[model samples]
Target: MNKALPMSGVRDSTYIPENILSVPPNLSMEAAMKETEEVIFGAIVSVLAKTKVECSEIGILIVNCTLFDPIPSLTSNEGIV
Candidate 1:
C-alpha cells in the first residue's frame, strides 16, 4: 500500500528583510490554514512523484506538527482520515 508522509521543515528568520516589520499582522487563521494545507499537499505530491505512487493507491497519510493542536482531539490524523 502506498503511503503519504508529511514532514516538517524549518524556516530561517534571518531570511526576512529588516523592513518586514512594517507589514500589518492582518493575517486570518483561515488563510494560514489554507496556506499550510497547500504546502503539505505539495510536499506529499513531490514525495509521491519520486516514489512512483499513485494518488488513489495511498492508504494512509501521517503528519506531525509541534504547535496548533485541535480542540478535543489529541491527534490531527483524525481530520485527515
Candidate 2:
C-alpha cells in the first residue's frame, strides 16, 4: 500500500534544519546545542555588526525559550565566539 502523502498544506517548517535537527544515533545533544549556539550567536552578531552598538554596549540580554524551563536556562548556554 502506497501511503505517502504529497506533503501538502504544511504551513510551519521546523524539520528543515539538516544539520541541527536529526534522529538518534546520528545527532547528539551536545552537537545540537553547539549548532544552536552558532545559529543564535550568528544572528546576534549579524544584528550587532549591522548596528553601531558594541558587545560592551549591550546592557540586558533577553533570551526566550520554553523547552527546558528550569535551572540553567537557554540564555545560560553561552553564545558563539
Candidate 3:
C-alpha cells in the first residue's frame, strides 16, 4: 500500500510520515501523536510563512483528524496557535 501511493497520484513532494513508510507500520498511539504533530505543525508553519500571518492575530483555527482520538484533545494543545 505504501509503494502504491505515488502511483495513485500522490506527489513526490508530499510528506509521508515515517511510521507510515515502515514495512508493517508502527500504528501505536505514540507514533500517531508524533505524526499528527509533524503534519499539523508543518502545515501551520508553511501557511504562516507564505501568508505572512502572525499566529496571535488569527481569530479561528480548526484541525480535523479521524485516525485516532488523542488523550489530550488537539484543540487543547497550548503552543500550537
Candidate 4:
C-alpha cells in the first residue's frame, strides 16, 4: 500500500528585526533566506516523521523563494528530509 502526504508552512516577517518596527524595508536578505530554508526544512521533516516516509522514498523536493537568491543552496534540506 502507498500513501500521499502534503505539508506546508508559512513564516512571515523573516527579515524583520525584533527590536525595530518602524525601520525601513532594508531587511537582511541573507537572514531571510536562511529563515525560509529552516522553516521549509522543519516542515518537511515534521511531515515525514508524521507520515513515516523513508528518506529514500522521497523523489522530489522543491522550494520557492524569490526574494532572496544569493544566499546559498538548500542542500541542507536533504539532511532534513
Candidate 5:
C-alpha cells in the first residue's frame, strides 16, 4: 500500500481480501475466485456502459488469466459476452 512503490497508485477503495490483511495471511482459492469475478465483471460493465455497447454486439471475448482458470471458465459460467 506504499505510494512510493511502483504500481502502488491503487485507489483507497480497492477491494482487498481480508485474509491478505490478517496477521498470518492464508491463501484462499474461494476468495481469490470471488475477487477475480468481481474485478472482471466490474470492468466489463464499466466498459460497456462507457462505450454504450450492447452485450449482444460483442462477438467474442478472450479472458486471459494465468493463476485461476476454472473448468467452466468465466465466459461459459456467465453466458455473457
Candidate 6:
C-alpha cells in the first residue's frame, strides 16, 4: 500500500493473481494438458448449444492453439467428437 513501492501502478481493472503475465512456479505439463482438455471440451459444448447441432452431426473437427500441441492432439483428447 506504500506509494514508495512499485505496486501503486497496478490497474484497478486488472487482477494480478488471475492474470497470466508470468507463469506460476508450480505450472507443469500435466496442468497444461488438463487446461487444454477443459478449454476444448467447453468450446465444443458452447457451439453445440448455440447451433443446436448434435454431437454426432459433427463430421470433422479442427483445433488451433498458439503454443500447445499435445502428444495425442487436442481434438483426440475430447474423444466425444
**How do all models score by TM-score?**
0.52, 0.56, 0.65, 0.48, 0.58, 0.58
52-79: candidate 1 lDDT, tens digit per residue = 9898997766665444344543334343
Each model's C-alpha lDDT? 0.53, 0.59, 0.80, 0.58, 0.71, 0.65
Mark the regions of model 3 whose C-alpha exceeds 4 Å error after superposition.
Answer: 1-15, 77-81
Judge candidate 4 against the unseen true structure and give its global Cα lDDT, from 0 to 1. 0.58
The predictions' CA RMSDs to the true structure, in order, are 11.5, 5.1, 3.7, 12.0, 4.4, 6.7
Ranked by lDDT, the better of candidates 4 and 5 is 5
Candidate 4 C-alpha RMSD relative to the actual structure:
12.0
Instruction: Please give the lDDT score at residue 25 for candidate 5.
Output: 65
- The local distance difference test score of model 6 is 0.65
lDDT of 4 by residue, 49-80 (tens): 99999989988877765544543555554433
**Ten contiguous residues with the weakest lDDT in model 2:** 1-10
Better of 2 and 6 by TM-score: 6
TM-score of 6: 0.58
What are the per-model numbers of colliding residue pairs? 0, 0, 0, 0, 0, 0
Clashing pairs in 4: none
Off by over 4 Å in 2: 1-15, 20-27, 66-71, 78-81
> Which candidate leads in TM-score?
3
**Candidate 2 lDDT tens digits, 1-81:** 133333544334543444534554336556656656766687788999899689998888886544324346666555422
The predicted structure with the larger TM-score, 1 or 6, is 6
Query: Clash pairs of candidate 5?
Result: none
